[model samples]
Target: MAEITDDQINTALARGEAVRLAEPRAASVRYDRQLDRVIVDLTNGCTFAFPPRLAQGLEMATADELAQVQMLGTGSGLHWKALDVDLSVPGLLAGLLGTASQMARRAGRITSSAKAAAARANGTKGGRPRRSA
Candidate 1:
């Protein structure tokens, strides 16, 4: 693997900060224990919050572990050190709970009892008919 130098790291950091400044970014992040939500205060004077459980890598995190939320690299992202997770602020705000595959699985979940019942009912009707060859 190619080694990273200190200059490269600094340059990258600078670029990240520039990008953050070019767009609305988080000014602060907090975990509302009472509401069980992650709240972010943006520089644009707007607040955004979401349930931690709705996010991947944070579904099973304890209150204390999640309360350690911090703004990463000039507020371009959020970092949960204890959980070893990092999420982009823009991505989260844009409704990306995790990686594409993870989001796909989440979207495909059939956890609702009603959905299960419907599936069973469909199965009784022979489920989906195979396409003609």
Candidate 2:
């Protein structure tokens, strides 16, 4: 491992501050039981909400568990201590609910006109080709 340097630490901190300033950060957060959603109140006075079921680790969480959310590191993230789950606030805001494979699994169950059209197009090409192996 490389040795740490004061200059490097300062540079990294500066970059983090720049990112925090440029993005909407959580001022407060809560789990709305009635709505079954996690709501985040941003420092910019904007509010955002999403269903807990759509988030990977949160899908099976009880209302009590979902209510255990805490803001992490300058409000750039959210953590559920009991569930051992951590999610990036910016990533969530950008429509990312989980890892690639997790998102793909969820997406596979969704039906859309565009997806149907694409499937038909693929079928016209004899569907997916078989591997040589």
Candidate 3:
């Protein structure tokens, strides 16, 4: 592995500061049994919550395991040691609860009249345009 340098450390610190200014940082995190959700209290006095099932590794987590939530990396992430799970707070805020493939699959399973009509319209336009070699 390469050795760390002063310039690299400074640059990383600067980037972290920029992100801290723009993004919400979690002040505290907990799993609410009654609500069946993981709640995050932000430094800005904002509260965010999401069901465990929506997250990738947390889907099958029990209340005991979910209750072991801990903040990580200056509150930009969450960690569950027992579960061996780590989740990005920013990603969670952005609705990224799972992997790309999982999210795509979930999206593909959604059904609505608008979606149906759009699919029909696309079908009329030769289904989908073929990729060029």
Candidate 4:
């Protein structure tokens, strides 16, 4: 697939469209403001980083505030309550500014849940000692 370009992303924001940029199963997103970039960490271990300016019209907090941001996404878009910013992933990967970092943190949480489920199937509670019969 063609990589989403900055211009295309900008157009989407201009047209008010939500873009899905990451792989469908992307698990988490983390922003690294010191580097002025957002990192998209996937469950499969692939990562993509983009500049924060790509979120054109979205309201973003100051850099210091961005450093404290916690992001949540539906894999289609991102929301940062602390920054009052919301952006679509495709717009991000395409190069628009104001949004970044979809790290593996969320994905890791899902993986942990799956592991717990498997352990339960084996009659063992995850992260806890099993009781003797």
Give the Å shift of residue 125 in candidate 2.
Answer: 13
Model 3 stretches astray by more than 4 angstroms:
1-9, 111-133
Query: Which candidate comes out best when scored by TM-score?
Result: 2
**What lDDT score goes with residue 116 in model 4?**
76
Q: List the residue pairs that clash in candidate 1.
A: none
What do the candidate models score in CA lDDT, each in turn?
Answer: 0.91, 0.94, 0.94, 0.59
Off by over 4 Å in 2: 1-6, 112-133
Stretches of candidate 1 off by over 4 Å are: 1-18, 110-121
Candidate 2 to truth, TM: 0.78
How would you encode candidate 4's per-residue C-alpha lDDT over 6-66 as one tens digit per residue? 9998998866542343243246777686788767765557677766653443234566655
| lDDT per residue (tens digit) for residues 10-105 in model 1 | 999999778867777899999999999999999989999999988999999999999999999778899998889999998988999899989898
Q: What are the per-model numbers of colliding residue pairs?
A: 0, 0, 0, 21
For candidate 2, lDDT tens digit of each residue in 39-106?
Answer: 99998999999999999899999999999999997899999999999989889999999999999999
Error of 4 at 76 (Å): 3.0
Which residue pairs in model 3 clash with each other?
none
Question: What's the TM-score of each model vs. the native?
Answer: 0.77, 0.78, 0.74, 0.42
Per-prediction RMSD in angstroms? Answer: 4.5, 3.6, 4.1, 15.5
Q: Candidate 3 at 108: error in angstroms?
A: 3.2
